[model samples]
Target: MSDSLERDALKEILTASIKEQRAARRWGIFFKVLTFGYLGLVMALMLGWIGAHESESASSGPHVGVVDLSGPIAADGDASSQLVIAGLKAAFEDKNTKAVILRANSPGGSPVQSGMMYDEIKRLKAKHSNTPFYVVVEDVCASGCYYAAVAGEKIFADKASIVGSIGVLMDGFGFTGAMDKLGVERRLITAGANKGFLDPFSPQSEEQKQKATAMLQEVHQQFINVVKEGRGKRLAADNPDLFSGLVWSGESGLKLGLVDALGSVDSVARDVVKVDNIVDFTPQPSYADRLARQLGVAAATTLGAKLEWQLR
Candidate 1:
């Protein structure tokens, strides 16, 4: 009888344990469903809010596409040729847009990228002859930025703004002395005799200097040609130093015929364009993108801490 009772007790314990496990699994599934459902509801609400906001913004009249040319004019830069071109295209495509503005604030960058943007802007203007294009200089629109400004029908600048840098530049370092101090030898082999003219660690020959200067002069000539084409009769060519890579303030820039008018963003919008509403077409990072970047940084920090602890 005792043996039978022990057997019965064991069976009862096993059954209770199985029942408990099954109940736990069901609760686990319920929690997972609840979490996913909550996430879906939050996403739906966010989307609805975004849609409503966008609808309200669309109600505003006279869409003015504002392209921000605010930094180095390189492929990877904020004022990259690609981004500027995309903004200009958006402006041209917007049916409600009466004018497009290139809002510039830069000391300039790559000549090639600036030239390409200038060409694209001219082409777009030609395609849309009805729409007017203006360049509003913010702070310092020099060199490549000035080249771009000439492409506009009218260039405007703030009274205190700095403008005018019409020149080309190529910069590199000479590391011959540094390498010599470190007892390092440069092993550069080239098929052409003049191919390694600008090698940093190699001694610069007189011939190389002459060759580089000639190359830069050629580029400068190209820059001058583009400015002339864009500015037409507006540029005052009395001063040769205008193209000597020198910058000028807005007031002086007006005397040099570098800019058409002196005004601020509000002035341009209210008086020049005769539109009170301004739309910015500059691409901005989304909230989700910012959140992901923050999360990534946090994760990297955590991993680094754990690794440091392990190393210690």
Candidate 2:
């Protein structure tokens, strides 16, 4: 009886030990799975693969939609006209969006890109006539940026914000003198006489220079006309330096009628739009898109591509 009882106790102990081991293994697996799941979630969030749709969603009630136009306006840049227009289109389409705000902070870039955005803004504004569109300048809004900003119903800027560079420029380096010094002859053979117009490696011709100047003047006049049409009687018509490719402080810009008033996105949303809920409708480019754009820009730079016309 003693031996049997001893055997029974041993069996009980082994069974209990086995149960404990099984429980521990199960807990270990649960924890391992949880750890892996948490890591994957973090990676997804960091990679911008998740949570983008949530942020891009507009509020159900009345809110001000904001589209940021920062950096140089270029085809390959984040602040490109295509991205800006996409944001604007989304903002206008949203029923909850009471007013649209363009938060601009750009030095300037391509005239064509800027012009395209400007035209789109006008079209959107006309379509959404009830919804007011405004441009709130941050830090600086000059040249191409101003070109687009004028489409807004009103433009606001800080007291110290830089504003206004209404001009067009085409700049390039002449390598003719440098080639002479380096004992390198430019063997450029063009089918047409004006095909090599303003070629950096060749000596600049007076006729080509005149043609280029005339082109620049034409673009500059277009920029000036846009500002006039946008600002209207608010502009100080007597100010000679207004369109002389000069930048001015926001306070001065107000005096010169470049900006309508002094305000920010928050203030404008709250006071002007009568709603403080600012929903950002800026088109967030994916990681792959950004990488591809960078590659393209780098390739262009490597090929020594020059902008034919710029607002800067």
**Top of the candidates by lDDT:** 2
Residues 160-215 of candidate 1 have per-residue lDDT tens digits of 88887676655566888999999999898889887676676788789977876787
Question: How many pairs of residues collide in each model?
Answer: 1, 0
Q: Which stretches of candidate 2 lie over 4 Å from their true place?
A: 1-56, 294-305, 308-312
My TM-score estimates for the predictions, one after another, are 0.77, 0.81
Residues 1-312 of candidate 2: C-alpha lDDT, one tens digit per residue? 999999999999999999999999999999999999999988776566876543346546788999999998888898888889998999999988999999999988888888999899989999999999999999999999999999889999999999998888777687878889999988878798887878878888999889878978998899888889888999998989999989999999999999999999999999888998888889888765677777876422311335433334
Which ranges of candidate 1 are over 4 A from the true structure? 1-60, 284-312
Give the true-structure RMSD of model 1: 9.9
Candidate 2 clash total?
A: 0
Per-candidate local distance difference test? 0.76, 0.86
